[model samples]
Target: MAKPCGVCAGVRRAVETIERALVVYGPPVYARHEIIHDRHAVDELQARGAVFVDDLSAVPDGAVVVFGAHGVAEEAEHDCERRGHDVIDATCPLVLKLHKEARRLADRGYDVVVVGRAGDDEVDAIASRIPGRVHVVSHLADVERLEVADPARVAYLLQTTLGGLDTVDIVAALKHRFPRLATQDGDACSAVHDRERAALKLARRVDAVFVVGSGSAVTTRRLLEIVAASGVPTRLVENAGAIEHGNIDGLTAVGLAAGPSTPDKLVDAVVARLKMLRPVEIDVLDGVEEFVRFRLPSRLRHAGERSSPGLGGAPLAPGAALSHDR
Candidate 1:
């Protein structure tokens, strides 16, 4: 079997950890969205009694809900508290860092332009905090006529999953227009940046590269651009089913990679589909490995002290509700 991408492997491990701690009860363990944008992963969880809902109203009162990798807005958090629901925040730490950065920039009087797809939850949260001060940009040209209250005080924040090279081009355009714009120290997640780099390494050795991820995923789209920059043929597909055999016709060697939120099964499916077209040799390209891990909520660690039960299962201890604030 071919090796899985590091991000996909990490996400799978995280979900498994949560699964082991689950306790069946009211509403069947509600999740706010597709846990990690991988249909196979989400479907597997659904089969295991996990219920996915997009809106708060869909969750019954007092249900234990888990937030997806995409962090929910403060308003969503407030709603859960008001409804007396137990909440487990499963947002990736990198995304949380981006949210905090956006809030800090806006608070410092910067006209923040949160750029990504229009409907993505990450973009929505940043937009909600500073409505008038926030501007949304999708492409490099979108920055051409950016209308900020103060051009000199403009700043930019990106969705953690954005393509690396695409962000560079946008930042370059923004600098050309407003020379004084500031950005966070690290604009994109390390996993995304490293995966794009790995894809490029393979692209140079092959004529084409295939990126497996959902169409709406930002990181997967970026991998295509990174490969195309080297003048190689590249295709971005959600899974093996979307791969058009005609596109890779006559290509000697092909590179394979997936987005941070993609699952191993989808990558394997792509490898199997490609085999039907040609006897392709799979090269496991090496790149950076992420060792990042986030701590469970404090209340979960000391459940006995919680006055009320928390997410997944009962609080780690009784009368431990105070630690849930973290």
Candidate 2:
């Protein structure tokens, strides 16, 4: 099983923020993206009257708005200000930290290279913030083709949710080319490394592996890549309902791995389906839960009237986009 199986700290923070906003702001709180990758989680919140929209234009004048774990770009931040929506920024602290590092280097006249996937929302958002020439490396080969204004004035930033040997190798290439490459400390996601290792270990002892998560989420794709690379059959399922008997027909042992954005109920339901499919012993490997905690925006954190009236009701001042953190 995905040893450290639960929502990752960042995703957990986003989920909690939306939940709290719904409680405080009443029905129809708006989120610009799916926020939580798991459809089940979104569906549950939707049933509770949370409205998910594609753009700020869809959000009404008085509704509270949330930015998902995949941080928003500066352009969108400007839109929020114009719309005068009370905003709760749920961008993962790790992402915010990386964004800060990118801007710090860029502001100092350095060309920044971001190690991340193309078309990934978070990567796209990160790239949007850098005002200079920015390069995004999706593969190790991309490093060879990278050209910066000055190798000495170059720094690198990692996609907050990405971590693997490839990133290490690419960063190594950058260092080899630029003697003084400014790399970020603690940019790698330990959650990704831990979950991938757990899934690979489970793959060794199982006939097949089922990764519970949305394929759209980057973490789930990484798990499938690692598991499939191990030569074990792997299937990405959204929940227990996606499981088919044919997929596990002849399997005696099945490994379960969950993406960081996956919810607990999704994993639990998968485990239950596997057990119900046959009379087999189930083993959940020992796991230590994630220790990190990202504080929510003061508005969402005090959804219980602790500063409730001041936080949710008032539209952010013309220039204010995100609420101040506690």
Candidate 3:
């Protein structure tokens, strides 16, 4: 078992916000992107009346539009507003913090360096905020080729889901070349740091490791990379069905980890499947404990109040409306 691995607070908040909106507004709530990266989560919400779209234009006029957990480009928000659609911001607060930092760094005359994959939604959003001043770099080589206005006045912001070691190495390269580069005080979010720590520990003891999450989940990929780097064999599977018996035939110990967007039920199913395959000892490693909870947006909160009676009589408490079994 892997510790500090499962649905994260941000993903939970985003999903619950959409679910509440579905209960209150009825069918056809439009989401700008996948509410979170996980396909199962998106499909569950789609069944509950959430329509995920890649562009705002796909949504009908006057409909309620939701921003995804990864955040959206500024122009996307502007387009929604210009079209007079009701908007609900479901962006994770941590991502929002990075957006603010990017804007501040650019406004303060610093050439901003964003460390992340080029086409990732969150990376695109941050880079779009301050186009001319911000440059995205996924590797140290990208940093080396950067042509900034002033090397001495550069600030770096990492993608919230990057592995700790990757971020450190890239930052070190940037600092080495520019000497005066400014960076965030920490690596990714506390949850990411905690998961990496637990994965490293588990890798040291386990014969093999499994990461359960969608292929697109950056955090899950990061965890897999971290564990694999420790010289332990690791595989990423989306669910129990994806796990093959042949992979773990003779293994007595296996480590399991999940991304922020991975549902708890999916993780449980994987565990149950592994047990059925053969006799094995499951031990959840110890890691950081998270207590963060983001508040629902005002519109969603009001909608919840208006629709609470039909959803079991009391006020809808965040994710209370979601059907875990689904």
Q: For each candidate, give its TM-score against the true structure.
A: 0.74, 0.85, 0.85
Show the colliding residue pairs in model 3. Answer: none
lDDT of 2 by residue, 144-218 (tens): 898889888988887867756447788888889888988776635677777887888888889988888888876
Give the Cα lDDT of each candidate.
0.67, 0.77, 0.77
lDDT, candidate 1, equals 0.67
Ranking by lDDT: 3, 2, 1
lDDT of 3: 0.77
Better of 1 and 3 by lDDT: 3
Per TM-score, the best of the predicted structures is 3
Candidate 1 lDDT tens digits, 61-100? 9888877666677789899999988877766666667777
Query: What residue runs in model 3 are displaced by over 4 Å at the alpha carbon?
Result: 185-188, 243-248, 275-281, 302-326
Candidate 3 C-alpha lDDT tens digits along 1-326: 76787777667767777888887778888987677677876777788789988778988988988787788888888888888998888887888878877888888889999998888888988888874588899987897899899878999898877767777788888889999989654434666667788778888888888988888877788777778888889999887888778988888888887767677767777888887888767677777755555667776666543321111112345664422210
| Model 3 TM-score (2 dp) | 0.85
